[model samples]
Target: MDMYIRVKRSKSTYFIRCKPSDKIIGIKQKLEEIIDQPVSDQRFVLPGTGEILEHIKTLADQKVDSDAVVALTLRKDVNEFEEVNIVGPNDFYQSRDADDANW
Candidate 1:
């Protein structure tokens, strides 16, 4: 069966088409094509619950259903991964307005 997930970051949302049996790493591989970030540098979390998805785990194993919202965080330095920072649409509008003010 085909399922899709929404992977979100700051001001960016990637609608990834996947299967329930797919490993978390596989999804990260797909994301690499779009974001150019290696799987080692990427981390996925369940939005709200903050449950970290393991690379060896499948979507079904993690109870991730169709249309689930997953937060994508990247490694900042050496040891720690950055916090989830999915920006909303309003932020874009506000930032654009702020940029216009500078013009």
Candidate 2:
């Protein structure tokens, strides 16, 4: 029988279905496919306790049942920031010059 579980990441939740005998790594792979992120960058944890889900254990070993919820977080090594353009004080004043000229 296939077991179903809900994985919550940030504000999004994903429902995954698999066999109880399936390894945790398999689930992580499925999550990678869904989220378009590598398994190495993913961290699965139990809700509330912050306990990490073991990669070597199966769904059965974890006692995961249908509709159970697991929390997903990015690994520390994964970059969380995106490239952004910073506006320095000089740049801000330069851009404001045009508007200031009209005043």
Candidate 3:
């Protein structure tokens, strides 16, 4: 079976490196077109919990390809940026920028 994956950054999307793939952009664009929504919606459920990993739209002029696992990072209220709070089964590690460094 062919596996489909996406790793979204800030505003740009990094497509996973899947074999038998002619081009990543083709699939990405097709998916985007089909979804009629940003790739951010492509989320997966955290095992054992009800947490979801939502992809953020990445910037353009960037390179993203397959093999990149876009993980679901925890989100904080726009109001609170210091106080840490866990969201569902995110296994969320408090990060000032969600860059893997958990406080």
Candidate 4:
């Protein structure tokens, strides 16, 4: 029950994968900690849509028993730091390789 998350914007992207059993709030918190910022202070994205859990429902209906890929990205441009923190020109976690080893 792992999840793949992509936090990005026009210029950058940060890809993160975690167990779905891990709370989304926790993931947000961890990313904030990694970037030295707060979750609310950053942009909130839910993959294909801004609405969270859509990925869950979409996959569930398809009977896909695989990890969820939730791409969280900013719809508009944010400030430089905010962009860098959330999604900037230098996001270091892009094109991440999937690691099922955690499971």
Which ranges in model 2 have alpha carbons more than 4 Å from their true place? 78-103
Q: Across residues 6-28, which tens digit of lDDT does each residue of candidate 1 receive? A: 99998889999999999999999
Q: What would the per-residue lDDT of candidate 4 be over residues 1-103, giving only the tens digit for each residue?
A: 6656565545455566665455556666677766666655554444444444322233344332344334443324454222222334345443435553443
| Best first by TM-score, ranked | 1, 2, 4, 3
Which of the two, 3 or 4, has more lDDT? Answer: 4
Candidates 2 and 4, the one with greater lDDT: 2
* TM-score against native, each model: 0.86, 0.70, 0.25, 0.44
Best by TM-score: 1
Tens-digit per-residue lDDT, 1-103, candidate 3: 2444554433344454344333434444555664464443333333334334323323111222334344322224433222222243334345467686656
The residue ranges of model 1 lying beyond 4 angstroms of the native Cα positions read 90-103
Candidate 1 clashes between residue pairs 3 or more apart in a chain or in different chains = none
Q: Once superposed on the true structure, which residue ranges of model 4 sit more than 4 Å away at CA?
A: 52-103
Error of 3 at 73 (Å): 14
Per-residue lDDT over 1-103 for candidate 2, one digit per residue giving the tens place of the 0 to 100 score? 9878988765577889899998889999998988998887777777756667789998889887778888877755556622222233464355646667653
Q: Give the alpha-carbon lDDT of every model.
A: 0.95, 0.75, 0.38, 0.48
